[model samples]
Target: MNIQPLFDYIRNHVTLTSEEETFLASKVSYRKYLKGQFVVQQGDVCKYESFVISGCTKTYYVDTEGQEHIVMFSVEEWWTADLGSFITQTPADYNIQCIENTELIMISSDDIEELYIKIPKLERFFRRVIERALAASQKRIIRSFSMSAKDRFLYFREKYPQIEQRIPQYMIASYLGITKEFLSKIKSQIILEQ
Candidate 1:
């Protein structure tokens, strides 16, 4: 499978010599998952951190009440993983499942460390990636407290643009921490306002 998109993405973050790129290429593998297949399951240790090559996946957690709460969605060019599990080598609390058939470039945690030594600049790139993820997460937490449900839905639309069309309304509602019916009502209200 072509991994040039990954190389392109990396290039945007840091300079990579051809040899570094070639070595990095040899370190990663590609996997394709059908819709409903899971890349990482709750209670299992997550071994690979994956980058989306195509399609989409949802990162969610199932509560004790058996309710699924969607945390985020990863589409083409996005990355998905249970960062806590991947970084700590512990069991993951979240499940990352394919929403559409998905192809991903995967690197094992061990390989990532090796890449750090061989390509020092790659560590800088990953630091930026993780920091941004953390920042977005912090922003989401703040928004949840500060924004109204309707406003949260609108902001979700603005931030993830067109994501509404790709996943079920219920999943969107879960991400927004609202009931699907409420989300429907919000949509209707927005339509009326427009």
Candidate 2:
């Protein structure tokens, strides 16, 4: 499979020589999962940091009451991994499931360490990626506390219009910390305003 997207993504952050790109590509393997398949399960150690070649996956945790709380979603050209579990080699707290049939290029933790040692620029690239993820997470936390449900829904719609089309409404509601019924009402209100 073509890895130009991945190379381009890294190039946006740090320049990579052709040999470095080839070496990076050699360390990763391709895998595919059907919709509803779990890439990483709760209580199982996550072995790979996956880059989405296509489709979508969600990271979530299930409570004792069977409620699923979505932590994040990774669409095409994005990356997904349980950072703590991946780094610590411990059981994952969340499950990563394919929401759509997905293709991924995955590098194991060991391979990643090797890459960092062999190509220092990759370390810098990943640091920027993690920083952006943290900032987005922080912004989401602030929004959940400060923004109204309608405002949050509106913001989500603006930010990820494609996600709304691809995923179920209930999943979107879960991400927004709202009930599906409430989400329906919000959609209706938006339609009425139009």
Q: Specify the highest-TM-score model's number.
A: 1
Per-residue lDDT of 1-194 in model 1, one digit per residue for the tens?
Answer: 78998999988889999999999999999999999999999999999989999999999999999999999999988899999999999999999999999999999999999999989899999999999999999999999999999999999998788678899999999999999999999999999999
Task: In model 2, state the lDDT of residue 60.
Answer: 93
> How many clashes in candidate 2?
0
Worst 10 residues of 1 by lDDT: 156-165
Candidate 2 lDDT, 1-194, residue by residue in tens:
77787888788789999999889999989898999999999999999999998999999999999999998899987899998899899999999999999999898999999999999989888888889988999999999999999999999999998788899999999999999999999999999999
lDDT of 2: 0.92
Q: Go through the candidates in order and give each one's C-alpha lDDT.
A: 0.95, 0.92
**Candidate 2 — which residues are off by over 4 angstroms?**
none
Which lDDT value does model 2 have at 34?
Answer: 100
